[model samples]
Target: MSNIHVYSEIGKLKKVLLHRPGNEIDGVIPQTMPRHLFDDIPWKKGAQREHDCFADILRKEGAEVVYIEDLFRKSFSQKGSREGFIKKFLDKHGIFNPHLREQLEAYLLCLSPEEMADKIMSGIKKSDLGPKKQEDFSRFFPEEEYEHYYTEPLANLYYTRDPGASIGRGMSFHCMEKLGRNLETVVWQHIFEHHPDFAKDAPMWLSNESHFGIEGGDIAVFSKDVIGIGCGLRTRPEAIEQLAGNILPQDTFKKILVFTIPKDRKFMHLDTVLTMIDHDKFTIHPGIEATLNVFEISLGGSGELVYKDQTDKVEKVLTKALNLDSVQVLRCADGSFIDSEREQWNDGTNTLAIAPGTVVTYSRNEVTNELLRRSGIKVLEMPCGELSRGRGGPRCMSMPLVREDI
Candidate 1:
């Protein structure tokens, strides 16, 4: 059995799951960006090409990359799993159309893995509901609401980092407040519970049932003893409390650092602000490190509460709390106002460390990329002009399952 407990940022990555952008990017119209938690829609073809390059880099690094669609199809193939999932979806959405359910099930069963994934993520259009009935069906069900009632499928499943999170052998799924994103969470639950490749007799923690909302983008493992959580638009404070209570005691982690992000569209997740690069050093946005607040959370004899106020600059607090004599905070852009502000808005600081001092980022953020290169870090840049238009970066593209702790 592989070690499922991921303890550090600099750890050697073994296996990770990534979803390359699909047709869903084309469906994200400009009008729906804010509602769908996106800034702008990207060109689908370009996004896919960039994501493919990112996947190739990870593959070259010898990390096992699992595609979300492939895993979902594998889970669907298991006896009773697809039916059970359909039932759950129906119950959750209050869809009682027996005929529709039967038809949908039959259609789903016939699809290939890639087709199923695309339809499930991008969704089948309501116009594809076939010919209308001749009879006045309204009288049979007076309360029936039928305009575009067929499931408006989740289009952001490619940003696999937003649905759930895992660390140190424990996993917790996010309870999506928006109904559009719920299907992705449902798929995540199915994968963790039934996928033979990952289940491995591992215990699971669900955030949906607990009323604690958290996303993978907001969670980061700095070291075995340290974790950084971002509290902002997506992740709530209660979720952090729940996470600390559940995971800390099991691994005996010394601290969980909480970084409070700006409650705006630009700074959506923690990854937008800080990401580790090497031992005792990190890439950061000055606004996040200098302007935002930080809190130290720990479980004492009574319960979870503030262990210390770390609102000082993130670098200063990190050095003091971790007891490191020196810590380097590389600016996301050279200390210039326009470059820093512009790049940070596009998630420039968000880089996923493949290994110690090695990371991947969006090539479009030239200033941030240059900064990283100057720091002696190997930067594998992927052209994310189309991808970044959707308001996520490299950190939002992948979910790490296992990494060795520093």
Candidate 2:
């Protein structure tokens, strides 16, 4: 019921949003897994159990958990609520032909609000919607071989962190580069713009119509006046500059540290390779610890961000930007190069800090979790056998909508 406020990544989380994997996971076939950005298909029942357990963990840690499905359902409770959302959902994906939109809308409206919401989240089969006279015949000369679902099941929606991020008292509905993920923003936009609880005062920083792309996993607000954004595979440097131009005039954050990392899928986002776990302590992957490109993004009087590329190392760059005396960096899977590579691939460097020193991570990363415990940090491990198939960890699965200001 309040405005979104997240000024620090390690602050005590107050409210968070997550999506419990449902029949949606069952919809991903082996043939379509790669196209949908999934490393492996997950068992639906087990995935739901894993997600429910994850939500319970957050709740026990004193955070209010809001399911994305529930939010959309609530937004649809009122009369005539489905009109705008349907239009937005269809148009955002370029399904603009009036006839095709009508068929989709009609199919969606027949069910109850909750069912309608679920159908959208679970995806739609082209066959289920019936033959569309409006269906494009130009591309079907040979008749597509695969059973193509009109709306791809968002198998990765469970990783809510990548689609959107919470900035200081606002939200950024990022324009994801992947075709499947672009729909995630459209779904959240409807909830934020129309849900009864958030409609009155939801502060949105970036629009869903943005051309340049920035995924939430790459952008982190470390403190009130200092922030860090990654320039990597999912998030381009141009998008970071555009985001800086949009955020600078607000003057809430004085400095933006652009950490450029390798574009390999192993280190797709900055948070995967680097994340702040406490005031002065950070979890790092050894692979990129010694090599990181650092740049300072700040406002110039000309209404654009003036970039100050730094020759200093990452630690020195952080110290300067965050005004820290000296920061401690803990490498993931310490000791063995092989173990480091293996553990980091399983998201060992990704930690969800509920409070300052207490965090949550996958238990499979034995060496990394032990390292976290040895560092005097509380480690809460969750079952990730089925959940990790989507290639996301605790931080990637949960998006803190509101957090206690540090």
Candidate 3:
């Protein structure tokens, strides 16, 4: 009866969570794109169109797609919950100005729940309040500059995968590395804790309160008893160890494989450089293979931690982990150095698998898509000219809530 159940990466996806691009996309101006972790300013309308098509594809594949906004709005229905959430949200973001915080809360409470959700996600500007309030505020602190937003837009919320990962019959909330993305996990945490749909039965294996940074994009549920987490860039070794301590003790999870990937933005998360496409196959960027470092963590007989340094290559390590004799890896752009680099930058390896041998990817990664097809994998391609501006692809934008056991 658990609301969350994701045991394998390539299982038939039953339910998924997504966030359609909204006014938040417009908030990413060129001046702040770097701070927001966006490569370029995305065209708002075009991004929405691409995201809609992506959701449509999942629906066609028999997966039920849920929106983050809808669930969040529903979570606010309980009496006093909306006000409580607003206070916590403002406090967590360092809205310490007493008068400003009070005015903001009163202003937000004036809106309906749906509108409040929209405004919070889109951002509330200082100008939105009347000039009289701004004048009074300036009198209190003359040096404080008038800014565009009192609450910055949650631009990266659309990439639903980063806030948390759904494990076997449970979920793990992440402590995001980037300051801008920290609250993204808070939003989902509130929903999963208050929303009637998930609050009653959903299990939260990890909380987002850790000082050690971890991201959902780096956590991969490879099989029923094994998980692969990347420890570089967005995910830290300490966080992985924390996750291991929590998850390995569960009966459903027996071991965890930690892979050390390049600590670069282009390869920020594990799914950005490698993802499972089929039962025994993975689509990966060849650039990561040369320096791949694998480690194993499991529970000891006396309920303590047992660690090992794995000397085998990624394929060999995966083969042993999944109890398969061999594992196949499909290289991005068929191993062409320059072409692979270009496609990889566009998220060629970040493919989302809805079934055992099928995946969804960006149509812009033509070379990688063709390679997948030739390798006997069904490729469902979606346009990404605008959506790719966020530097994530199909896998990066989705969080599978329920998947059929393989």
> For this target, which candidate reaches the highest lDDT against the unseen true structure?
3
| Model 2 residue 244 distance off true place after TM-score fit, in angstroms | 1.6
RMSD of 3: 1.8
lDDT of 2 by residue, 237-339 (tens): 7778777776767748987999988878888888899998998889989899666888888877876678898988777777777778988788989756999
Tens-digit per-residue lDDT, 1-406, candidate 1: 3535577776767788888776665666656666566776667788788888888888898888988887877776677776687676655555566666665666765776556655767766555555434453533653333333366556677777788877777777877667667667877887777788776766565555556667778888877778889988878988888888777776657788988888876777888888887788788887765467888887787655546777577778878766789789888887577999988877888888888889888877899888888888899888877777767887788888788666
lDDT of 3 by residue, 275-362 (tens): 9999889998999999889999999999898999999999999999999989999999999999999999999999999999999999
Whole-model alpha-carbon lDDT for candidate 1: 0.75
TM-score of each prediction: 0.89, 0.94, 0.96
125: Cα error in model 3, Å: 1.1
Candidate lDDT values, in order: 0.75, 0.84, 0.89
Clashing pairs in 3: none
Ranking by TM-score: 3, 2, 1
Clashing pairs in model 2?
Answer: none
RMSD of each: 3.3, 2.1, 1.8
Total clashing pairs for each candidate: 3, 0, 0
